[model samples]
Target: MPKNVLILHASPRLNGNSQTLAETFAAGAEAAGHWVSRISLAQAQISPCQACGYCRGHQHRCRLEDDMDKIYPAILGADCVALAAPLYFYDWPAQLKLAIDRLYAFGPEYSIRDKETVLLMTAADQNPQSFGGAEATYQLALVDYLRWRDRGRILVGGLNEAGAIEGHPALIDAYKLGYTI
Candidate 1:
């Protein structure tokens, strides 16, 4: 069965290591006959969510009109979501977090309760603990809030320069993860 996979690339740099990993994963997924949509948050005009309680009051929809509206439907339509980014100051880029926050408008019914989620990240530090904080954030915010099944996580560390993840062992893992999905 072909599954719809949403890849959210949160790096501001176009050719960042994280984006490279994301592209590899997307390619593997496509080779396996899955549909993949990669969205670059840096290039998109996504606004932050203002907690007006409007979505909660009005049937799980946001009042603010922006790029987020377009993403809402895509998320609802996706069978799986891959959050890809380079670790920044111990967490995801601000834009990615913004997207995740805005997704709260989808409400419980439209939430990713049964959907699978994969977290892919690259870091300059070689230590595994470098990504712990960011991973914990996803585990708490996305996994717990949306109640999604965790497919797996791929973290490539010690890649400071752009596109460094291309030759990393984690790239192989990411490819396998995508193809298996």
Candidate 2:
């Protein structure tokens, strides 16, 4: 059966390496008949979670309304969520992290356990340690805490300039990840 996959493009730069990888992944997923929706976090107006304990009393409805209103439904409807981001100072961009932090609105009933997840990342640094922080966070937060199934990840390094990842082999890897997910 086909799955509903949501691709969160967390890179602020348009057509950047990370976004390109995500688009390639989406293409393969589409070819394989899975429904894919790509959301650019840069364009979203999501606010940081205030840790205000509003959802607990309000039946999971967040008090501060913003673009998360749209994201909540998208997440609830997705069978898989793919996060594509570039390593900035060894971590995810603020846009993606903020959106994720807002997920606390769901509280204990968060739509996390059932969904499969993917991580696609790029970095200018070729050192393996460059990705350690991101990998650890992904494992600890999304995989361990939320219990989201690990689908696949494509981490490409040494791509700093614009369009640097255009001809990179990771594109094929990303496509394969999406196709096989």
Candidate 3:
């Protein structure tokens, strides 16, 4: 019953608080004997979607061949997908958004629906409302678009400095979520 999990870290900073939370979640998932793979979008050369509509016509395959080409297969094969990023201007970083948009390739035609997904995020502000937009996007774009069952979400606020999530309660919660997966 080990699920295949993919964690997409969208933080530009390698050790950013969000990335730390992602690592914590991954650790928990691994402890639970789930297969996990973590990919850092900040370090990867993922191209933005070109609205070419080629993928829509061509079997859910993106036309522009790049790192996205590499990621597409993983997305299809995953039993669970986790999107991790820091809140930026009440939304995810552009890199993450672009990568997400590109996933449009797997539109309704492909039937990549009913998978499981989790979202993990960190922000400088502690306001619970600060992450609404980003959370909404994940719900609509990833969960609804792919018809994935929502597993859960971990939103950590008031963490700005890099690695600030270390030893935080949210980190512990993330670990538990992963382990429970």
TM-score against native, each model: 0.95, 0.97, 0.95
For candidate 1, give the lDDT of residue 177: 91
- lDDT for 49 in candidate 3 is 84
* CA lDDT scores, all candidates in order: 0.87, 0.91, 0.87
Residue-level lDDT of model 3, residues 1-181, one tens digit each, is: 9999999899888988988888889999999999999888888888888989998878888889788977888887889989899998999998788888887788756466857999999999989999999988888877766678888999989898897887899888899999998
In model 3, how large is the Cα lDDT of residue 136?
A: 88
Q: Please list the residue runs of candidate 2 whose C-alpha ends up more than 4 Å from where it truly belongs after superposition.
A: none
Give me the runs in candidate 1 sitting further than 4 Å from their true place: 108-110
lDDT of 2 by residue, 5-97 (tens): 999888889899999999999999999999999889988999889888989999889998898899988998999999999999999889899
Arrange candidates by lDDT, highest first: which order? Answer: 2, 1, 3
Higher-scoring candidate on lDDT, 1 or 2: 2
Question: Scored by Cα lDDT, where does model 2 land?
Answer: 0.91
Per-residue alpha-carbon lDDT of candidate 1 for residues 28-128, written as tens digits (9 for 90 to 100): 89999999998888777888889888998898889898888778888888999999998999888898998998977877565557789999999999999
Query: Which 10-residue window in model 1 sums to the lowest lDDT?
Result: 104-113
Best by lDDT: 2
Listed per model in order, the count of residue pairs whose N, CA or C atoms clash below 3 Å is: 0, 0, 1
Superposed by TM-score, candidate 1 places the C-alpha of residue 13 at a distance from the truth, in angstroms, of 0.7
Candidate 3: list runs displaced more than 4 Å: none
Query: Candidate 1: global Cα-lDDT?
Result: 0.87
